[model samples]
Target: MEAPLVAALGALIAVVEACGAAVVVVGALSGGPARRARS
Candidate 1:
């Protein structure tokens, strides 16, 4: 319930969301072509 703790928690959530988004984008980009090749 402190300001610094709240700020840090928000920052951590943002970082996690960003990393997850990047991973999804990269996976989709790589999978699209490879999936087509196999099919």
Candidate 2:
């Protein structure tokens, strides 16, 4: 019932947070290369 729905929502939130963290790491890693190329 409501419990299952809540659990699903929580799982979705965790996945979104993980994706955001990965993006940040990737952006930080690539940012250096991009800046060097521009310069």
Candidate 3:
């Protein structure tokens, strides 16, 4: 009962963190070239 709920919440948090990291990585990669070009 409680164990399953805790597991589910942990999984959800892990997924969200992974997604956030991916977005940050992608944003940095996409921004890098533009920033270099401007300079």
RMSD for each of the candidates: 1.1, 1.0, 0.9
Worst 10 residues of 1 by lDDT: 1-10
Q: Per-residue lDDT for 16 in model 3?
A: 100
Tens-place lDDT digits, model 1, residues 1-39? 699999999999999999999999999999999999999
lDDT for position 9 in model 1: 96
User: Model 1 has how many clashing residue pairs?
Assistant: 0
Best by lDDT: 1
lDDT for each of the candidates? 0.98, 0.97, 0.98
Across 3-38, the per-residue lDDT of candidate 2 in tens digits comes to 999999999999999999999999999998999999
Error at 4, model 1, angstroms: 0.4
The TM-score measured for candidate 1 stands at: 0.92
Q: In model 3, state the lDDT of residue 38.
A: 98
Clashes of each: 0, 0, 0
